[model samples]
Target: MPETTLPRPRRLLLLSVSAGAGHGRAADALHAAAVAEHGAEALHLDVMDYVPAAFRKLYTDFYLRLVEKFPSLWAQLYRITDETPPDAAMARLRRALERLNTRSLRQAIADFAPDAIVCTHFLPAEVLAREQLRVRLHCPVHVQVTDFDLHALWVVPGLAGYFAASDEVAARMRARGLDPSRIHVCGIPIMPAFAQTLDRATCAAEAGLDPQRPILLLMGGGAGVGALDDAARSLLRIEADFQLVALAGRNEDMLARLRTLAAEHPRRLFPQGFTRTIERLMRCADLAIGKPGGLTTSECLAMGLPLLVFAPIPGQEERNCDYLLENGAGLKAVDAVALEYRVRALLADAPRLQRLRDSAVRLGRPHAARDVLRQVFANG
Candidate 1:
C-alpha cells in the first residue's frame, strides 16, 4: 500500500490588540475565516489582554494618545528610524523595539506554541522576527499590514510573508528593499459581509434614512476626534441640504455632545454612538467621511461608496489619503473650511459625484477577502 498520512489541522494563533478598532476587527475576521477553513479549535488572542495591566495601558492607550495628540513627535521618530533607506542603523532601532516588546511576547509564544502565528499588530510581529533570528522557531510567522501603507515598526526582517492592502503598498515595500516575493497584495482583510451589495434605497430606508438626499457618514478612528463637530457645523453652515449620519466612535462624550448639537437641526442630522452595524450604515450612505484607515478604505471600496477624507493621522493615514487622492478614489478635506467647500461642490454636481462613485467601484475588489482565504488555505 502507498504511504498515507492523515490530514492534520495546524494550531494557529492570531495575535492582535485594540489599539484602534481596525486591528482587532481584522484579526477577528481572519481568525473566523481560518477556523471555518481549518477547524473550530483554532486559538486567537488580543495580545493586549495577554500582558500585564500596566503594559497594556502603555501599549494600547498611551501610545495612541501620543501619536494622535503629538503627531510631530511620532513623525520625527519615524524619520529617524525609517528614513535611512533600510540600513543597519534603522535595523538596530527596529530590533531594539523588538527586544523591548519581547518581555511579554516571549511569554505568549511559549504558552501558545502555535504551528503558525498571524499578527494583526506590529509589536508581536517584531518579537517573532527577533525570535526567529535569535532562536530556532519551527513555525512560520506572518504579519498583515492593517493600513494602506506600512510604518517601519511593522517591517520585520524575517517574516514568512506580508499581507498588504494594495499594490501601492507593495510598490512602497519594494522601494524599502523588501523582496517582492515576500509581499502579497491581498487587499485589506475585511469581513466577507462587505462583498454582498445591498440596494441603496432599501438600505437607506431600512436604516431610517432618506434615500432622496445626499447622505454623509462622518467618523473618526475609534478614539474619535474634535473634527466631527467642526465638520458638522461647516456642513450645515455651507447650506448643505442633506441628511447627515455621523458615527462618533467609542467617544461617549463626543457622541453626547454631537447629539446635543444635532438636536438643533432635527431633519438634517443623525448622530450615532459606537455602532456595531457599520456595514448596514455604509450601505445606506452616499459617501464615507473619515480617515483612510486600511480596513475602512477597503470596506468603502467594496461597497462602491466614495470617500471624503479629513484629519488623516500624520503617518500611515497620510500615505493612505495620498493613494486615494492619486487614484481618484477619494477627496481630501484639508480643513473644516475646505471640507465644507468640497462637500458642497461634490454634492451639487451629480455627474462628478457619479464619477467618483464609479472610480470607487472600479478600484474595489469585492472578492479580496475570499482571495486572502484562498491564499492562506492553499499555502497553509
Candidate 2:
C-alpha cells in the first residue's frame, strides 16, 4: 500500500481596523482560534496600518472623537449612513475614496496569498470587493459583522460570504440580496478563554474579590470613554452588600480616578487598568454594567454573566442592548439613577438575577470562533 500524507494547513488572513476595539478584538479571536484549535497558519493586520498616516488618523481618531465628544451627532451620522443606499452617489464617492486610500492593502493581500481571508471590519472587505470587480481574487473573502446590527456599508457586492453576529443580522444581509448560503450566523467570535470552565471562587480570589458577596463588573469599552468614575461613585452609594469591579481600559486618567475612589471605598471597590485577565474577572462577576459593545457583550454572555447596559451609545450599542433585552439575557438603564436602581433591584432579587444568567447561558455561543473556522474551511 502507498503511504498517505496529510494536507497542509490552510493559510488565513484576518483583517481589521483600529477605529474601535471590537473589530480588532474579533479578528484577534478568530486568529487565535484558527492557530490554536485548527493548527492553521494565520496572519492578522490592521487595515489602517496599510493606509497613509493622514487617512489613518482621520479614519480612526475622527470616529473616536465623534463617538466620545458628540454621541448624538455620531448617532445621527450613523443613521444617515445606514439609511443611504450603497449605490447612492455619496456612498459611491465614499467607497471610491476608501479604495484610493487603501491601494497598498491590495498589494499586501496579494503578497500573503491566503487560502481564506476574513475581515472583521468592513473597510478591508469593501476594498477587496472593489478589487475583485477589477481583477479576480483567487481566495475566498468573508466579512464578519461584529455588531448585532448590519449597516449598509457592510453589504459589499462581491464577497464569498458574511459572518453575522445574530440571525437578525443575517436576515438583514438576506434582505440586501445576499445569497442565503453565504451568510453564517455564528454569534460574534470571542477569545477561547471565555469558553473555558473557570471556578468563580478561584477567579474572585485572584482578583481580591469575595466570592460570598455579589460582584458587579463595570467597564467602558477599550478606550474607556464612559464616565466610569461617576458611575462607580453612584454604584458605591447603593446600600448593598456587594463588591464592584471597574475596569478602565487603557485610560490612565480614568484608572487614576478609579484608584482614588477605591481608596475611599477600601475593599468594597476594585479598580483595574487594561488587563488580559478579563475572562477571569468576568468569571467572578454576578452582573456586568457596561456599554454593550459587541465583543464585550459576547464575552459576558459566554461567561453566563448577565448585563446591565448603561446609556448605550445611540447606534450599535443601543441595538446590542435591545438584542440582550429581547433575549432576556440583560437589562438596560438609560441613566445613572436607572443604572443604580436596576443594579440594586437585580441584586436584591436573586431569582430574577438567576433567570438572567440562565438566559445568557442559553444564548451564548462559546465555540463561535471554532464554528467560523470550520465553516470557512470546510471545503478546503
Candidate 3:
C-alpha cells in the first residue's frame, strides 16, 4: 500500500483534572466544542487519565479535604493567591514548574502538536505554560477561566487569550495589564447538552414536581457542602407550597439524611445524589438555593433559573455571588433565619421571581461554546 503523505491528523488535546467536578465539566464542554469544530477524530485525551495515580489521588483528595474540613485555611490560601500581582506570582509559579511531571504531558503535546491548547483548570494550564518555558512548545496557550472571577492561578505568564466567564472578569484581567485584544469576554463554556435540552414541562413532570407550584432546586456543586439542611429548614418556615429538588452531589450521606427528613413531606421536597442531568433539572426549577459555582451558575442561567445564595465560600464563590447579586440574577442571605425570610419574600412575590428569571436569561450566553470554538480555530 502506498504511504499517504497528507500529514498526520491534527489533534486538539483537552487538559483537565478532576480536582472538582466543575473543572472536568468545563473540560468536557470545551472538548465537545473543539470536536464540533474539527470532528471527533481530531479530539484526544482526558488529562486526569494521564497523570500518575498517586499524584492524581493527592491532587483530588487534598482539595476535597481542604474544602470539607479546613475551609478557613483554604480561604486563606485562595486569598493569598488571589492577591498576587499578575507579573509576580504567575511567572514565579511558571518557573517553579520546570520540574513538573511533564513526561506524559510533553509527549502528548509534542505528538499532537495541537493546533492550540484549551485549559479548563488552573494546574494543567500552569504546567503547560511552564512546559512552553522549558521546551518552547509552539502552540497557542488558551486559558479558560472556569469561574466568574479571575484567580492569579489563571494568569499564566504567556497565555494567548483568556475566554473569561463574564465581562467583569475581563475588566479585572485588563487591570492586571492583559491587553484587551487577548480577552474574548466569552461566557463560561457549558456542555452542548445544555444548549440542546429544551423540555421544561416534560422535565418537571418526570422529576415528580408540580407544574404549578414554584420549584426550588438546591445545589452546592460536587462536594455538596453548604448549609443545605438549614436552607431546607428555612424553606419550610417560609410556608411555601413549592416543590424542592435538592441535589446533594456526591455527598451520599447528605443525600441520605435529606431523604429521611424529607420523606415526611414527599410532595414538598426531593433530594438527589450526584447527577449529570442538571440541564434538565434547571429547566424545571423556579429558583435555586446554593453557592454560586461557575459551571453550576452557568447552567442555571442558561435555563433562566434564579438563585438564592446561602453560603458562598469566601473567595471565588463570593465573587460569583457578587456578580449575580449585582446583576439582579439572584439575592444573598445574611444567615439561616435571614435566608429563610428572603426565600419567603421572593417565593411569595411572583413579580420578583419573574424579574430574576428575566435577569438570568439576559445574563446567559447560550452560544458561548461557539464563540470559544471560533476563537480557537480562527488561530489555526
lDDT of each: 0.78, 0.91, 0.78
Stretches off by above 4 angstroms in model 1 are 1-8, 37-40, 52-54, 84-97, 100-104
RMSD of each: 3.0, 1.7, 2.8
After the best TM-score superposition of candidate 2, give how far the Cα of residue 262 lies from its true spot, in angstroms.
Answer: 1.4
Which 10-residue window of candidate 1 scores lowest in summed lDDT?
369-378
* Candidate 3 or 1, higher lDDT: 3
lDDT of 1 by residue, 57-95 (tens): 877788688777888887776566655554577576755
List of clashing residue pairs for candidate 1:
none
State the lDDT of candidate 2 residue by residue for 1-380, as single tens digits: 99999887889999999998999999999999999988999999999989999999999999988888899999999999999987789988988889899888888888988999999988889888867777767788898899889888889776888899888999999999988988899999999999999999999999998999999999887777789999999999999899999989899999999999999998899998889989999998999999899999899999999999988888999999999999999999889889889988998999999999999999898888999988888745
The collision pairs in model 3 are none
Q: How far does residue 74 in candidate 2 sit from its true spot (Å)? A: 1.1
Candidate 3 Cα errors over 4 Å, as ranges: 1-10, 40-58, 85-98
Clashing pairs for model 2 are: none
